[model samples]
Target chain A: MEEFEPKIVAFCCHYCAYSAADLAGSMRLQYPPNIRIVEMPCSGTIDHRVILDAFEKGADGVYVAGCMEGDCHFLKGNYRAKKRVNYVKKVLAEIGLESERLEFFNLSAAMGPRFAEIANEMTERIKKLGPSPLRRKGEEK
Target chain B: MIVAQQKPLEEIARLINDCQKVLLVGCAGCVTVCLAGGEKETEFLASALRIKRQLEGNPLETVTFTCTRQCDPEYLLPLDNLIGDVDAVVSLACGVGVQYIAERYPHKWVVPALDTKFAGGSLEQGVWAERCGLCGNCILHLTGGICPVIRCSKSILNGPCGGSQDGKCEIARDVDCAWQLIYDRMKALGKLERLMEIMPPKDWSTARDGGPRRAVREDVIIDA
Candidate 1:
């Protein structure tokens, strides 16, 4: 049996998380390549439909990484994203999707190592959860 | 405005589980103002249901539409073409919208995706508090704009009910004693003397006990 490689989508805010990912790349920090990073102007732009659509289209795990609390570029964008992520987690839970499969994180652009750490952390979590139940039969891991 | 809440995703999925295709109707009336049913919500629910069904291996097809006001006949007439192929309809509007769709498309199964909550106003974004009891009468004038019929835990017309303490109801710490609010409001308006006049019991016939009521405006009717 081939080892299961989980497909993860990371919604990275341009001001913080996305820049952090860039810093991590420059710093040469090692992290699992199982995750996909989607850059957004602000994490506050994340929508419930888009996140759920990720799972519907076959993402095993998803997370929104934003600026630290009280540190959003648009004043309260990260706070808005945090609330939205929690709400979507509840919706996922209601549909029998493990709420743990979704997460929200806050960090500054300077946290290069932390960005890599989160990538590795999400990879292990999804690996443990196995493939999403929504994934069709005989599809890629 | 009438406030409503969306039903749980699991329950909505169960309602149309047997069908391969469904029409999710949203209303742009009271339900829209309350954030329960509107174009965005209707689309979101359709996506969620499709995901649920796909996971179940049944693969559902969903068509979403938002009506100007599902409670009115004219708003639902445009759905006639879309109704032809659907096995069922999931109405995201209030209970009135569900019945309207069901009545319009008599041959198809229709279900409600929202729990019609109350006649209320938005306290803030994502929060709503009830304000009216729909008693078919106006009484706010005497109560200084405070309504004990709905705000009061027990609907006490002339009372602090001995359960009011520190301006809060005995039912819960957050619930304000309606009479207490009325007393304060009335006192501020120099109408404290009005409370001394022994008020009679309300007429229950004007309320729900009167059965389903209707209002006819002959001036607005055009004989066809």
Candidate 2:
């Protein structure tokens, strides 16, 4: 039997990480297919609910990918994203969910290989941690 | 403003456990301005709880309402209809708003959705830093608008102790020296002479030490 694959959601900022992921695909880089990409105008636009909803909807892991620090297209959108991500992590921990399920990453649009690396790394980490405890009803087990 | 943030989704869900109908109330006053409890947040929480309930095989109905100010009785009156029908009310307000709801509807269950922090202002667009202690006293004039009671970390009246180094606070490496900011601001305003004036130690009795402080004004009172 195949091992249970974690369903991961990647909230990518349109300015950088989304483009980087596309570049990774063009480069034919191998990464986990279980990851789903949601392109957002800026990582800052990613609401707290998006992270919670991902878990509520059976996602085993979620990660936000934004532009490198000080490189945000919207001045301090990435900084806001970082703060919200930290706040969400604390919220998850307080609610009995594994805080590690959510993560924030920064990289330039040119870092295609970096995107592939993160996909593989996050996939490995989630597989080790098992499925998200908040997975929708029957999705668990 | 009284800054606050929402409690964890699941924790909030558990708090209202067994309530089939929930009235998710948001405050449009301080909490809304701070982005802790507002209409958007109320919707977000209601939807999350709905999902959690569905997954647990227990159906739940959430009704969201935002009041001008949950801490005031007039604004709370609008929730009267919803309150009578819902199993519980989840207040996405500060500590004061939570208590206000409880006090107004003594028989209803009022649950807190956010953790009440302190009187502070945003350092940037989304970052909030403590700015005032609201020790029931006003000493900002003497401190050059820099609040020593709150921002100083030690709440020291005479600060920037010998422990201060390179403008950074000794107690915490990341915190800037509050007293230094006060000194600089006062000096820039040509009020350096005021620093020589000694301020007596703060009297705790005038604060929470007074046991539930109250204020009354005969001029503002109206009698039938």
Candidate 3:
């Protein structure tokens, strides 16, 4: 059987996570290429619909990375994002989907190695979970 | 505003289990503000239902629409054209909206996607707390703006009941005793004597005890 490669979508806050990913690249840190990063002005701007849409569009796992607690560029954007992520997790569980498929992470822009580590961690997690049940049969790449 | 929460996805999916196509109706009034139902929520629910049904091999099709306020008949007119094409309607509004849609499209099946919670206001960004009982009578003036009818666990009119302790209600420690709040407010206003006056028994007829109430303003009516 061929090894399953999961498609993971990461909504990265431009103020922190996105810049951290750039720094990781500059530092030559190695991480899984499975993660597709979609930059947002702030993690708070990523609504529940956008996250669910990623799953519907064939993402096996989704995560939002934002600034550390009490460090959101927009005052409390990360906090709001955390609350929203929890809400989506509950909704996913109610729909019979694994709540673990969605996650929220907080880190500083200077943590380039940590960003790469998260990429590898999320990728490995999704790989073990296999393709999302929502993914149509022929849609697998 | 009216607060509501969405029903579980599994329960909602079960409601329209056999339907091949369904229309999702969203309300832009109170439910929208409360985050239970709106254009975005309508789309989300439609997507979720489609995904669920597809996984089950039933493969449901959905059409989505949003009305300014479903309780008003005029706002529901847009559904007339689309109602004929769907087998069932899943309303993301409060219970009122569900019934309004059902009444507007009498022959269609209208399912409520939200459980209408209460007449309340947002406590914070994502938290809402009930504040009113909608008893069809106003008494906030006498109570220093505190509502005893709804805030009080026992709905006592005179004063705090035996259950009130340390400003909390007996029903729940977290619940603030309404009379305590009223007393504090009254004291701050130097109107403690207001509580001394004997109150009359509430008129139950003004509330839901009266069957299906209606309010009409003759001044606003123009004979057709």
Candidate 4:
């Protein structure tokens, strides 16, 4: 059997997580290639619809990465994003999806190692969870 | 504004279980300001319903529409052309909007997604508190803008009921005694003497007990 490669969507805030992702690449960090990053001015800009749309569009896992607590470029955008992510988790559970498929992570722009670790960790988590039921049957992984 | 809350997701999913196609109608009026049945909430519910149905192997097709105000006949007219295309309509508006839509489309199944809460305003972000009883009567002048009909658990017209203790109602410790609020406000404004005056028995005819009431302005009416 071919190894399952889960599709993951990561919403990265430009001031922090996005920069971290870039640093990870420059540092030659070995992370799973499954993560598809969507850059945003702030993680707070990611709405519930955008998160659900990622899952509906066949993402096995989704995570919003924002700045560390009290370290957001915008004073409280990370805090707002954290609250929204929690709300989306409840909504996902209500919709019969595993809440574990969605997550929120906080990191500083210098945390390249942490970004790679999160990418690898989320890939492994999704791999264990298997494909999303919303994914069309017999579709490629 | 009229405050309302969305029904639980489980109940909503069950309500439309047999439906294959549904029009999720949202109101841009009171429900929107209250954060219950607004455009964002409408889309959220639509996505939730679709996800639930799709997971159950019964995919649902939902079309979302937000009217300027569902309670108005003029705004609801836009739905006339689209009403026949769907099996049912899940309205995320308040009770008035739901009833208006149902009345407008007698043949279509109109299900309410929200439970009409009260005539209220936001106390803070995401927190709404009932402020008016809509009794077709105004008594705020005597109560210092604090409404006993709503804030008071027993709706006592004269003063705080016996259940009021330590400025809180007996029903719940967190609920402030409405009369206490009124008294404090009136005292601050040097209008405590007004409370000493006896108020006549309220006219009940204008209240809900009178049955459906209508407000007519003859001067504004034009015969068609």
Candidate 5:
């Protein structure tokens, strides 16, 4: 049995999470490299289709990083993203995946350390869960 | 509009689990406006079902299509070529779409993904409230646009029953008294005098009591 290396997809908002990622890089913050970040104009644009599509495409874990409460660049984009994340969690459970495989985090662009923390936290969670159930027999690596 | 809500994903998956491949159809009509069934939803469900089956070691193939309106015959004709070879069909439209698909392709299995709720309008971004009873009669002129038939718990025709309290129905605190809305609107319009006339019992025949109903316009008929 080979080691299970999880594939995690991160949907990051341009106004906050994306900038926070840039700051994390500049600050020399260390985090897991498993996550593949997809930049978005706003977390509010997160669609259930896209999140589910990630799982369908063999993402072992997924997360949406948005602005903190009451600090969204578009007034309530993070709030809207929170609602959509909660919704997709239920659907993931229905599809036999642990709802914990999906998550939503709120942060500000200045919170570089916090961004690294979220990445480490999500990585640990996915590592414990192993590969996604949909991962084919010989593809977990 | 016919408001609807999607059924849980587990139940929908169970309905089509025996099939190897299926078509997931969406309607661009009322269900779309209600955010229940649309092109996006159709693709989402197809993906969810595929993931569910794949997790179980049984891969499911899905084809998706969005019809203009499933209830109309012409709008459904495009599916003639798309329905081939699928073991079953999952419709995300309202109940009407499910039944229409079943009738059109009698040899194939048809499943409904939405629970047809009511003939109503959107109350807010994601909320909907029933506003009409579809009783085959026009009574809005008498009730000042507030329909006591569907809005009222008892469907009282003439006056508010004793269940009304503080502008709310006794059945639930969240339910507004339909008669209260009628009174407020009529008074605002200075049409309170109209309420003074003793109303007669409604003729039940015009409603569903007459059995399945149909409406036809001879002028619009075209020889086939």
Candidate 6:
């Protein structure tokens, strides 16, 4: 049987994570194929709904990758994104969903290797968690 | 504006349990202005619910709709098409909007996502205070524009009671005694004479005591 492939959605800040992903590609650094990146002008622009929507659309894990705290292109965009992630985590917990499914990471545009590391780390974490319980697979309410 | 707070997240989650399709409805009226039941809140709730369902193994589908004013029947008509396949509606509107939906769609299950608080406004970003008492009477002129009914701990019509000390109410340390505020303001404005005149007892007949209230303007009436 094929292993459960966790669908991870990564909301990447255009100035950092996206650039880092591009740099990783240029550097020939291979990462997990599970992560699907959605580029945004700033990580702060990624509303809580967008992350939740990714999960709703069958993503087993969601990530918001922004610039390193002081490195955010929009000054405090990454900070706002961080605050939102914390709030979403609480919301996820209240709904009985593991807060671990949503994550935020900071990396500089030049950190191609670090970007790949995150991709691998998040992928491994979700793999161990298996399919999301919300998948409507087994059991009755 | 009427300010309300979202119901406890856990309670809201339980209300939508077992539903395969849910509509998270938001209102753009008072709720939207107060940031309690607006499009953003709808998105937050829909996302949370979706994640919850996914984790529960029953992954339910959800759609979002925001109306200008859910309390009005006309505003909700547009949602007729959206409700066709949804099993339940999670209303992020005030109590009036929830009742309006329940009244219009007798067969559909309507769940309230917010706890109806009061006719108030935001004191700051996240803090809201009760401002209107809806007492069916207006006496702001006599009270120096501060409403004792809603602001005072005792709603005293006469003046500040003995419990008032150093401009704060004895009941709650943080609360500024409403009558004390009125006294200070009136004294400042040379309107202290207004306080000497006793107000006739408030006749609440026009309020909830009158069963229900209605207002009709004869000049604006149109025969349908």
Best model per lDDT: 4
The TM-score measured for candidate 6 stands at 0.84
Q: Which digits, one per residue and each the tens of the lDDT, describe model 3 over residues B1-224?
A: 99999998899999999899999999999999998999999998888787677667788989999999998999999999888879999999998999999888888999999999999999897799999998998799989899999999877898799999999999989999999999999999999998898779989788888878989999999999
Two-chain DockQ for model 5: 0.85
Cα-lDDT of candidate 5 = 0.91
lDDT of 3 by residue, A28-86 (tens): 99998899999999999989888888988899999999999999999899999999999
Worst 10-residue lDDT window for candidate 6 chain B reads: B48-57
Clashing pairs in model 4, backbone N/Cα/C closer than 3 A: none
- Is model 4 an incorrect, acceptable, medium or high docking prediction? high
Candidate 4 chain B lowest-lDDT run of ten: B76-85
Candidates' lDDT values, in order? 0.91, 0.87, 0.91, 0.93, 0.91, 0.88
Report the C-alpha lDDT of model 6 over B37-96, residue by residue, as the tens digit: 999999888887776666667777889999999988999998899999999999999999
Ranking by TM-score: 4, 5, 3, 1, 6, 2
Residues B1-224, model 1: lDDT tens digits: 99999988888898888999999999999998998999878988888888777766788998989999999999998899898999999999999999999888889999999999999999999999999998888789889898888999898788989999999999899999999999999999999999887668888788999999888999999999
DockQ of each candidate, alpha-carbon based: 0.56, 0.18, 0.57, 0.83, 0.85, 0.61
Worst 10-residue lDDT window, candidate 2 chain A:
A132-141
- Chain B structural similarity (TM-score) per candidate: 0.98, 0.95, 0.97, 0.97, 0.98, 0.96
Q: What would the per-residue lDDT of candidate 2 be over residues B131-207, giving only the tens digit for each residue?
A: 87878888998889889888887888977688778888988888989998888898899999998888898998777
Residue A20 shift from truth in candidate 2, angstroms: 15
Candidate 6: regions farther than 4 A off: A1-5, A20-31, A68-75, A107-116, A135-141, B16-22, B57-63, B84-87, B187-193
**In candidate 5, which residue pairs get closer than 3 Å at backbone N, Cα or C atoms, i.e. clash?**
none
Q: Chain B TM-score of model 5, please?
A: 0.98
Residue-wise lDDT of candidate 5 within A1-141, one digit each (tens)?
A: 666678889999999999999999999999888889999999999999999989888898999999999999899999999999999898888788899999999999999999999999999999998888788777646
Superposed by TM-score, candidate 1 places the C-alpha of residue B163 at a distance from the truth, in angstroms, of 2.0
